[model samples]
Target: MEWDIAKKDFKRYLLLERNLSNHSIDAYLNDVQKLEAYCSFKKTALAQVDARFIQQFLVFINDFSISAFTQARLLSGLRTFFAFLQIEYDRKDNPTELVESPRLNRKIPTVLNIEEIDALIAAIDLSTLEGMRNKTILEVLYGCGLRVSELVTLKVSNLYLDVEFVKVEGKGSKERLIPIGHHAIKYLKIYLEEVRPHVPVQMGHEDVVFLNRRGKQLTRVMVFLIIKDLAKKIGLTKPISPHTFRHSFASHLVEGGADLRAVQDMLGHESITTTEIYTHIDKDYLQSVITQYHPRS
Candidate 1:
């Protein structure tokens, strides 16, 4: 089969069979395209690719000094693509089956302390319309442990404020109910009832919770800039983003003795291993506490 036809088939398989989100589908296709480009340069067909060719592609990518994590992710994407070829197109062998993925070091995520979170929130000027909305944004992000994508796509219909829970659509379009804290719910009500209604919402974005001044849905980049501006205002030197709030939420929960499984559910992690990173953050916190208090010096 031609590379274009194979990729088109792969896209359909990812969407219909795998039920992956558009963003994830794009990433997988991009990874496969890189290999296709390499094949084109080598004058080889997709069906003719072997394990040796796969290794050569890896070496070529490694020449650019990409991070091991990215290399591993690319390899994973290629494996899925080749797997699709084998299953649908009746390819004889999987090139990635013999190729080993690069080992990745698990880097601990940056987390903000409770004081820092409070400071960031307190720095927001609540007098203006956008200020109230921005405060609510930060509250929901920190309180719900939501991804930026989830936060932006949050809907009014999904919020069960009386029950103090919000439904979040997580990775792979999986839905989970997260219990909202008093602070998040309080501000959420303020935004939805008082602040949001005043703004003229554009067509088709009526269900979206957060809206810009244009009455349209807020993009992920806008949320990041809001957080970035707040961090700068607070003089926080740490490199932080929307994900930092999520990390802080999970890390604080683990530090406060919350159940591992419970944290996993709230974070919408597919595997317990993915949630275990917060435990490592907790360990670092504990080590610091002991070092600061203990008279070992």
Candidate 2:
């Protein structure tokens, strides 16, 4: 089939069979479209494309100075798209099955210390409506370890605040229950009760947990901007984003003696190894533990 026809088939599988959300279906299609873009540029087509061509594209991405992470994601996305094709059309095997992803070097993400987190939260003045919402946003994000997308899409029905847990649909549309702290829950109640009712919401987003001044759902960029503004206000010199809270959430738990596997489950990570990458060991804290419990010192 031509690439356009193949794309339509993939789109149907994603929407009807897989029952993916519009956002998710769009993303998966966009991934496949990247390959199509490459083919168009090179005056080739997907049906005639081969593994070596894919490899060349990977190298070409590097030549254009694409980040290894971006390169890896594009390859992984293509791999899944081809896998989906293999299932739909039983005539051919997947070419991407044995292809290597971009060689990625692991780097520990920057984390917010407990004190810095407190400062960031404190910087949110609770007098204005936006302040209340901002405070609530920061608390819930750090408390629940939510991705920006998850936070923006959160609905009133998903919150089981009475039970100290909230249901979050994460990447790949995976659902997980994450624990919320009492402090976070407290501020969230305040925002829900006081500020949220005041915002002028659009028709479809009334049930959304967070809202802008106009009562519409927040964009990912809004979350990013919120965090950036908070960082500037608090004189935070390190790089950060909405994802910083997630990194801090996992890191703080590990540092507080939470089991690595437990952290993995809470973070909704597919592998413990991915979760392990978030740990930031404080040598002074480690030494303090040893000093207090040494048999002979």
Model 2: per-residue Cα lDDT over 1-297, one tens digit each:
688888899889888777677887787788788778888999996767778888887787778898888888878778877887778766276667667887788888988888999999999888899999999999988998888889999989999999999998887687999889999999999989988888998999978999988879999999899889989998999999999999999888888889998889888888878998867687678998889999874
Predictions in order: lDDT: 0.94, 0.86
Best by TM-score: 1
Candidate 1 lDDT score at position 233: 98
The stretch of ten residues in a row with the least summed lDDT in candidate 2 is 89-98
lDDT score of residue 33 within candidate 1:
96
Q: Which portions of model 1 show Cα errors greater than 4 Å?
A: 281-297
lDDT of 1 at 78: 94
Q: Clashes in candidate 1: how many? A: 0
Kindly list the per-residue Cα lDDT of model 1 for residues 1-297, writing each as its tens digit. 798999999999999999898999999999999999999999998888999999999999999999999999999999999999889988889999999999987889999999999999999999999999999999999999999999999999999999999998988898999999999999999898899989999999999999999999999999999999999998999999999999999999998899999999999998899999988645666789999999993
Tell me the spans in candidate 2 whose CA falls farther than 4 Å from its real position. Answer: 16-50, 60-62, 172-174, 197-203, 283-297
For every candidate in turn, the CA RMSD to the true structure comes to: 2.4, 3.7
- Over all chains combined, what TM-score does candidate 2 have? 0.80
Model 1 TM-score on a 0 to 1 scale? 0.90
